[model samples]
Target chain A: MEGKVDTRYWRFCLWMGPTFVLVFFLCWGVLGHNFPPFPPDTPASEVAGWFRENHNGVKLGMVIAMTFAPAYGVWGYALAKILGQVIRDEHNIIVQLARLGAAWTTMAILIATSFWLTAAFRPDALPDWMIQLLYDMAWLLIDLAYAVTSVQLFALGIGFLADKREVPLIPKWLAWYGIWVGFMFAAECLMPYFMNGAFARNGILNFWIEFLIWMVWVPYLTICGFKAIGRIEQE
Target chain B: MREAVQADLASANSQSATDDTIPPGDSGVWVFIIADMCAFALFFVLFAAGRIAQPEVYEASRQQLDGAIGLANTLILLTSGAFMAQAVRAARKGNRAATLSGLGLALGVGLLFGITKAFEWSAKLNQGIGLTTNEFFTYYFVFTGIHFLHFVVGIGVLFALIARVRKFDLDTTQQRWIESGGAYWHMVDLLWIVLFAMLYLMRAA
Candidate 1:
């Protein structure tokens, strides 16, 4: 019975990966500004124009994005269950660290949504600088602070290598991929520092390349975790 | 008893042949290592392209770097990598003493690299060089910072390897661990080789 429950939990975890991508795309990709994100120096007047152009839709997008933000916590819960089987010892601090990372990221996403909503809430009466402030904060939260996600992945990667289960949960190499991606996300810290170059928020390396890599990583983790669950249940 | 000994000998012979054909370490670590190299390759390309686009900026920045320190660090990493390779070899032969000594040499050299890097960074900081100093400094700091992080992680892995080696004999898992450690150390060495040439040695565009 306990095993059955675990299987169910992981299935939900797998599902959330795509759910995140969908909600993320609907807001940040489909509804949000351009892919690397709009430049930092984008004037408030331009943002006001966008808000005027897409008012209700922008608000609705932020609401939807905020609603889906808690999916991070569920993902973390399921991940902890899976990783716990391997690092079931008292010294498993990384597992706790991973949970903290997940919580921090979720809070961050919530704050980011608030920033986006503020930009769209009032444009005509508010000063251009105020709207621009909201815009800058939102994008910076997403791109500049990618280190939070990096920590989450790094913890998971460590879990994979440290897991001594007789039937390992995931392949150890996949763990390396997790660690690699986590490290790469650190590139985004340079995003706000570059307004015009490839490292800029809207630039190729920081925005386009890094975001695409993360998209691929989401599905990879989901499929691999799903397979590992199957293997564990069969055992 | 005689038949059991013969069976053992047969398996031992087969094991060596397998070792010759298969790559070192777990297939898992190799997968990660290869992908990591690909990422570095992209960085190299981007850095080169950036240099080409802003030749004067890159050239001026390149002149400010200390090539001698870079060269020394390269040799240090190379020597440490060599020691790691020797450690793996000794572990395979079940020579505990040799393995420990090799690991120690590698660890010491690896630590030296860290110290030298800290000095180099502080010197640059004293000179008012920073991540946002210019395009060249930005790339230089970010690139080297990321690599330095990897080096720190690598040192931890080395320490773990040393502990494991001292605590246990070269069982199958231990053998795999040795391979994985060697693979990781070599990666650190390999990344530096290219970074040195590009950041410290290559002629300005």
Candidate 2:
């Protein structure tokens, strides 16, 4: 009975991680709806038309997306908690860098969602240029400014590597995968170039593969954390 | 009984790791290196594909890039790799002084490369050749920028290696740690070579 109670805390920590992952699923603002946003060279009128046409849907999506603004900080806290399991220090440098990245991502998410909301806040209220400007800003923040999240993932991988246990807190493969996913987000840097090809914001290298890798990172770490819990038996 | 027990211990140690069969460094670093390599390879492949699509733009970008500086950086990295190879060789021979010096020299060369590369990047930026200037400059700034980031990381690895060498001991774990750092430095060099080839040397003209 005591053992069950003890494990519940571990399970709860584990649950916190996957819960944010679910929040991530709800974070499909651009990718889900106005995906690929407007191309870098998208005309102001065309972008204005999007908000005018999909005003309600975009606004609703922005609201959901804004959830990530605060939600990402919560997500980062959950991740930092999990990171605590593998990393020893309360303020370890790598972990600190990760926390910074999380905070930055949180702010970036807020700014991005605000941009989207402003764009959808009544397209007729502003000039086409302003609508277009907000639209571009929002998409760029969402896709290209992924470095914040990527840094946290890299820090997690490094933390796993630094663990001295014979059986690591997080295994090497998953650690490496986290690092890969983080670095691969650099692909978004290319999205501004080719609009229709694989590097396009919506295309494979930048969006599909990179996005898929990111979606996998959280759940993968959650599972690794669970496995680590099993190894440290109370008895 | 004692003689036999000593003999058995010797055989066990011998069987554990031979020079030919042993991995160069810690296994974890290899995983990190391979993943890093694969990430770079994807970018390389994408660069190739992009070049094929817009050969003229890529070629023009390639041309505008100052290849002499690229060549100099390559030479710097190559020289650093040689120093690291020497460091490992000295470490293997149990020559602590030579090992420390070799690693120190490599670290110096790495720092030099980083400084030179920074100047090169600054020069480009001053010329108004910035990211988002065009598709060509996009890859230009992005690739070099990421590579520079890696280069700094490699320098950090080398610094750690130099410290480890200064605390020299010819034990298995220490040897592996030092070797791992050397191997990683070599990987940094190898990656830059490939990047220089792709970004500067290979052009349509």
Candidate 3:
């Protein structure tokens, strides 16, 4: 029995890719005050002071971030399904791996945000050291968990590179860029080793360059995903 | 089969003549190389900023580094890059023997670079200097460590090129593969030169 495929729903899923990007940047980045994240070497009292002043904003940001965390998974699913179509192998392991990576990435984001939320939940009652510890723990968990997102990009890149079409669904340069971005995430591994320098969680190399590259990659891939869906529908 | 091989050689030469406008290697590989360079540039900027912030610490750390070893690794990578260039050129000419020899020499020299780097890192580690020793050593270990990763990947690419060239004729696509791998190997060399200069030779003040 042939069942009808809903191309409209697929398009909506692809649209979620950008929606996730916008919401994530606003809530987790700007409102959460993670745009210029607290330095790893920040004193416990300072950490507590900042949280005390911005607890409500932090709480709201983390709540919205956690609620919409699954948007990333939905976006990944849509991208992977389109990738399966491009490779003409619906059961390809790389596609599933990409999907799994996105799911785990969502979990990482969710858990990290929850830690921040809990830190904000009782900033007045908790010790300054406790708040600082929670903050540090959240950053470490999110930064070091970069490999999960790397796996997703690598799988997607490999999948796109394997497409034999003369005009591939995803651009070849974008695929290479994705792989390069994934490789750059290796810098995050050095985050735990340094407290203030370039390799630190808040340093230029680890935080600004790494996250900016990832942010650029998401929109690039989302645009490509939208185009790929349109092309697949036409075919 | 021999005629087919000869045909491929002629095609490669003709393609080579017309493809001058195209940059060496696969454009996709170039994309990766360019992005990787941008990342390393950011690393260098940050290192420079840190050095400026603590010039005395950086200068002291620079003195502690073995400059002779850094210079020697620079030469090794230069030599490896030359061999890689030779390999790509030979592949274009469909000279299988020279291609293999060039690749083999490049891979060997690349391995020597790795060995030298391992010894340098171990020596430092044995001296109780490591990534977290200070801002200077932090930059040192992190920069060199990441460059070491690129070198390792370049070695793997060279090995893969050798295996591919061994089994298949140097068709146009295989030639492109060689060029791409050679491009990446050269990039590794280029990055190390900058790293060597920034870390070992430059006066922090």
Candidate 4:
């Protein structure tokens, strides 16, 4: 198995995970004006007003985000491959499911950001209600489609836990942490029912707690993945 | 040879009895538990802020809640937690019958809490109160709803422990599993106590 593996290409793919994270936080999060997202209860006129003022930035940010979204898919593929090795079953159902989850998660980001882009594309001509509707639609899709990402996290965590090595590649504590992170995403289910307060999309629990932990998990996992690959090569 | 065998048995038992360096379950499980507690702490803070922001609404909503039911649920969880502790202790001592019975009792009592919660939630919905009703109801539903998810997961963990205990006398690793599951169940119970205090017992104003 080691002889057949291309370690260099694998490392390159693994690096894409952080690359995806950096680009996403910069493009979708900062420049897209999503860092402190507008409250869910914002009126249509105000929603339209922001879009009118910042349409160019939104367009740039989301377009960059959509283009680089596939980096996440590549990173997921690398993660699944490493997980296959860790669990010693390339054809494991969990590994395959995680791979599919990565694909779908990427699509979720792409489709949702496209909505934001469209909202900005014709913000001047479109009705204020329509622009607000598009904005709301984008948030609903991005936040509600969290289950796919959760599946990916769970599969990876489970796969790591299944490793029987004397010293597992990923620490058991981190695996448990990953599972906890996956479980926390269930809070996103409350987003639709909340237009304000902590359960809402921009609220503390839903956005700050949920997304911040996720952001931490991704970079943490990426670092661990790099170390795990190095260790496997030594073995 | 027989004396040597007895001495070895005694040594093993003594080590199991006296070893207090490691935690109840293992360090990994404690990590999970601590992280979960931190998340719940954040939720509690957010709830307090919400109350402070709207004292009258929170006070009115708190009045509508049934403190008796909250107390009942708290007692139910406490009882279930005690049974779970018994199961873990029995498993550690190799008392299979006691372990199985204790687990069974715990699971049965835990299910009653769930049934009660279902009824409570249904009653609220019948009264036209829901997640979207107001700030207080929203907090009430979401907090309890998330806690209910934890309860469901705890039940599954208990069932898994029961199956393992029924199948064989636990070895060291299996004993750790029992301890870990027991710790998680206790955490669930502890979270409920705080939730009950905040939502039902405390003066919202």
lDDT of 3 by residue, B1-205 (tens): 9999877766766454345588767788889999999888988887888888888999999999999999999999999999988888888888999999999999998899989999999999999998888888987888898899999889999899999999999888888899889889989999998999999998754
Q: Mind giving the per-residue lDDT tens digits that candidate 4 earns over B148-170?
A: 99999999998998998878667
Question: What residue runs in model 3 are displaced by over 4 Å at the alpha carbon?
Answer: A1-6, B1-18, B203-205
- Point to the candidate with the largest lDDT: 3
Model 1 C-alpha lDDT per residue in residues B150-179, reported as the tens digit of each score: 799889989999999988877877878887
Q: Clashing residue pairs in candidate 3, if any?
A: none
Chain B TM-scores, listed for every candidate in order, come to: 0.90, 0.88, 0.91, 0.90
- How do the predictions measure up, each by TM-score? 0.88, 0.79, 0.93, 0.94
What's the best-to-worst order under DockQ?
A: 4, 3, 1, 2
As for lDDT, the candidate ahead, 1 or 4, is 4
Q: Residue-wise lDDT of candidate 1 within A1-235, one digit each (tens)?
A: 2443346557876687678778868885667663546676677688778876776787888888888888876776567666766575424788877777777888898898888888778766777778777888888887766888888889888988887866577778788888878878888777777767778887777877788877887778778777877766775
lDDT (0 to 1) per candidate: 0.80, 0.74, 0.88, 0.87
lDDT of candidate 4 over A64-135, digit per residue (tens): 999999989899998898888889788999899779888999999999999989999989999999998998
Supply the TM-score of chain A against the true chain A for every candidate structure. 0.90, 0.82, 0.96, 0.96
Report the C-alpha displacement of residue A127, candidate 3, in angstroms. 1.0
Task: Specify the CAPRI tier of model 4.
Answer: medium
> Measured against the native two-chain assembly using Cα atoms, what DockQ does each of the candidate structures obtain, in the order listed?
0.52, 0.33, 0.73, 0.76
Q: What does candidate 1 score on TM?
A: 0.88
In terms of TM-score, how similar is model 3 to the real structure?
0.93
- TM-score of candidate 4's A chain against the true A chain: 0.96
RMSD of each: 4.4, 5.4, 4.0, 3.6
